[model samples]
Target chain A: MGQDGSVPAYENASKESPQPRPRLRRSVEDGWIAGVCAGLAHHLGFDVRVVRATFVLGTILLNGLGLLAYLVIWALTPQALDGEHADAPRPAPTSLPRLDRAIRALRTSGRDEAFGNVLGGLALVVLGAALLLERHGVNLRLGLVLPLGVIVVGAVIGWSQLDRAERSSWLNESSFSGRRGVLRVGVGLVLTIIGVLLLATQERGWAGMGDAALSALAVLTGAVVILTPWGLRLWEKVKREQAQAIRATERADIAAHLHDSVLQTLALIQRKADDPAQVQRLARAQERELRAWLYGGGQSAETTLAAAAKAAADDLEDRYGVPVEVVVTGDHPLDPDTQALVRALTEAMSNAVRHARPPVSAYVECGASGIEAFVRDHGDGFDLDAVPADRLGVRGSIVERIERHGGTARIRRLSDGTEVALTLPVHRPVNQSLNQPVNQQTLPLKEAHDA
Target chain B: MPEPRATTHGPIRLVLVDDHRMFRAGVRTELDDSLPVVGEAGDVDTAVEVIRRERPDVVLLDVHLPGGNGRGGTDVILGCAGTTTESGAPVRFLALSVSDAAEDVISVIRAGARGYVTKTIVGEDLVTAIHRVADGDAVFSPRLAGFVLDAFGAAAGEIAEVDSELDRLSAREREVMRLIARGYQYKEVAKELFISVKTVETHVSSVLRKLQLSSRHELTAWAMNRHLL
Candidate 1:
């Protein structure tokens, strides 16, 4: 029996300890007639032949009740191959009897009207039986049975109509005012009137009318219940459409916003295409600005100072066709001030590519307190003090742009290369805001340098 | 660059669309002896109007222009083609641009331009590109062909898989990829790496196949996206 390779290792371990009582699971490999007796023997730690003999004796002694019990056990216990092992007790089985499944289906079907119709039909059958019994002088009450039958029919019709109206209420209210809603109202009124008339024609005249009026009340109550849900659903649908319309208008506003700002900037760029250098500078600066704005100005999780520095270096290399090696040390999200700092670094890189020779590199070091960038080039070094005033490439683009943002720019001349270092505090200065005109500040600096 | 071929048919009619008037004039003076200029427009709207009215055999299109609703060259192509070609025989567009940026190249090519060339191209090469595009053969500036291949050949989702393939490249192959992606000419890459141009070509093709990339342009974009450059 143990030679079966299909039995998992855990099953063997389970067989060694029988005190805790392993769960009952059908044996797939070793079993006759659905493995019920073998499974029971394995779980209970008894000889398989003894369990089988007991089942047979019990079946004969108990008038085949034991056979019925065996069938029930076979249906209830899941196969061990289905991952239900004797050592591991599973949660309550999901496999239900056929009768339980039918009850569950009826409860969860969501067809309330259909259920009501079925109950009404059964009531009608009972009413008809009672009427036949009365004709044979079986003493059945015709008045009670007839009124009950009329109420049940009215209620069923009201229920079905209400369910349909509620479902259709998602359509516009104007559409609901068409023939369908009116037809339902007319049918409900007619049924309610018929119920009242039936009561009036009962024996004892006006007093019988009172008793039959109860059936009319039931019909009216059912109709009200149907209409109430329809009204609520219609209200919800109207609210949803209003919200949708508001969102659509908001989207249109955003589209117009993009057209006014981003599209206009693009048009300006295209107009300046004749001056390739100006276009390149504008395109690079505008791309960074737009990315900062569109991505919410450093609020995005991915926008780090190191990433911005690397991108600026890459752009400069591609634009000028110069080789730039960028080394970034620390990473952190950038504020608008630091974004300006990065743009200034880009201008410095471009100057290095333009004025300096090949083998240019940028080093960026960011910390919690401040950030610094050094753009170094391996060209003939130039004296910073001797730069011409009209050469706004270094003065206007790098120095003033950084200084205006409460940062510092320093130029150092090496024996064979020049390095421009920029530093900025983590927080903006009290006097500096994002809207400050950096260009206006740079214009005066250009005049001072030129003078 | 290829040599200009003698045409068996009549002079290839052409329209020039560029925002820069000087550039248009330069191209006109260079190619006037070979291909006759039939029409011209500075922006997308007038470009479409002139190309449709003239029914030119070829149109030298610029990638970026004002007006035409901010879409630039793609708008001109669409305005002329609508859903399909209006002239029965489709009007071919040869994109001319100063920008060698991959996005600019890929966007115009995706909009169905017959070919693309940078403004640095000499007059003879420009004429050759025009002739090839008129003959319904695709032409591209050497490295620009890689952009078209990358945009159309590989699915966008497969680009993420390129990261794993980067590990598969040998050390020498990695050096060639970085240089090529950095916008180096094949000869320049060969010179920089001290290898023959043929050896560089072999390494490039091997690297492209291993990375499942279609062209050098895609390799550049892939490297740039991974920050490997």
Candidate 2:
């Protein structure tokens, strides 16, 4: 409903990009009211009560003229869920749930801000003031003719029609489709006729009609304030959202990396490696690196490395079928170097989440011996040699990231699953790693040496 | 129970309470003559009144009813469903909710509901469930039953553990320990147990006495460590 026609600011559908095809009906799994307003508010990012208030008031006012339209709209809007989508099939009727969610995903995506606060707050305040002002006015006031009228009309049509998909389908199918361009042409003609009528009635308004219009003419000049540096203002907001998006992608990328490549390779390495002592050493070494990357304190708005790890794990389990379990120690903040190391470990975990099968849980443990992480599955294990050589993550994310931290990285197969392990120094001094600026880009590894 | 084969049974009595006319109509069409819809009401007050008036035995109630999900229906199931027994017992209420929200489902059961079924049961399951509820059998959707049993089984485990622990301790000791563990600090535990702090301490000491423990930490730990927690 925002001007751009994206999902309304209240229902941030594309803001963080809603996860694919997970049927989330009004959470009949959890419903209080029709839960229609709640679902809309959830979709639009508005408080449910705010949506409900709008509906209640709209319904009371439009009960005579436009109520039927509202109900028709309700019957048109798709329910919050698809019931069962391709990603999660519906279970059989005879039994309990046999649904399996196969697609691996990450929940808790970056917070998307589709609407700014000031605009929303201003809309609420103005609506309230105008409603109060209407007490003194008689028939067809200017405010009622413009915004209030739209609110009444939209509320009646939008809220009711939003819930009824079949009505929408029928209208779209029966009316629009069969009649081809006739409906659109008819609607456009009606809108044009209304526009012409409003233009003709411009002089028929009430008191101050001319004087008020003259005074309003002065305010239009003040629009110069915003219009003067239009591109510059627009540029700033765009930059800000882009930066925010980048930060989100980086956080998401780190989670995906950990779950997919590093953990998978380490688990593989752990399984195939012959020397027990070497495996423990490698696993211990990888643990330290993972903690530093995830929990070690950093300049990011994100949490400590360990907390980040848990969030990543939770995100993995919730979004994907992969189950994640975490172990935290010494609730103290960890430095970014440690955080960076943990970031690498987190990537390994992401690899596991993506590649491993059922019953294979991603595990993370941090103690006095540094931090340790692993993705262990009971599914089929892959050969280290057979792993796709051109894989972007192993060459680019794992090896390159560990090398930057002056650590070693390895991948091998375990008896039951594959593991990716990378070990780095636990307590490297800030001065030693201070050669590069914090904002410097990570080096992309050359694929020629990866395999 | 073993999976029962679908039976060509006679019409089952059923009641539906939901505000949506279209959904109600759709449901009615699906089960038109397969089951006899004894009555239907769209709101809370009407739903309760209809159930009481018809006593149809299987009332399909929506969780998101006009007033609220199952507030009045739950009451009817728990406190007002059947005619007064010699013991003044109530009839069982079967809740029909669209959601499988664990809390709502359990609350209905705790309210003496005989069955809980979600609206997504399609038509067949919904019809079958009505007959089962009419027969006085407890019915729950497979997933919903899992949620019920998980909670019930956990509570059962706690009960078994508490019983065993009580058996493990002397009567007086068990009494004092239960009060203490229920968030009665030393002084409060003493007051409730009807003893002075000194006497309570002595009892606590002796209870630790029988349990073979030392220090309050060890006593609390001993109980917790023994899974008395």
DockQ numbers for every candidate?
0.01, 0.02
Q: Write the per-residue lDDT of candidate 2 for residues B1-229, one digit (tens) a residue.
A: 1112223355555677677777678788777675777788887777777766765545666655655344645654543444421222233356776442445554465555656665545576566656655544455443332232123221112222332242134445444543332223345546656787655555443432222222223334322222100
What value does the lDDT take at residue B148 in candidate 1? 23
Q: Across residues A69-153, which tens digit of lDDT does each residue of candidate 1 receive?
A: 4654443344456544544333234333344335434543423323333343344334433443343344335444443444443
TM-score of chain A of 1: 0.37
Q: For model 2, give the interface RMSD.
A: 15.4
Runs of candidate 1 with Cα error greater than 4 angstroms are: A1-190, A193-237, A244-348, A352-451, B1-57, B60-91, B95-112, B115-229
Best by TM-score: 1
Q: RMSD for each model, in Å, please?
A: 25.4, 26.8
- TM-score per candidate, chains pooled: 0.36, 0.26
Candidate 1, after superposition: displacement of residue B129 in Å?
7.9
Candidate 2's docking class is incorrect
State the lDDT of candidate 2 residue by residue for A196-295, as single tens digits.
2433344544653553344233222222221222222234446556767988999998988687656865986668599765564455345544544544
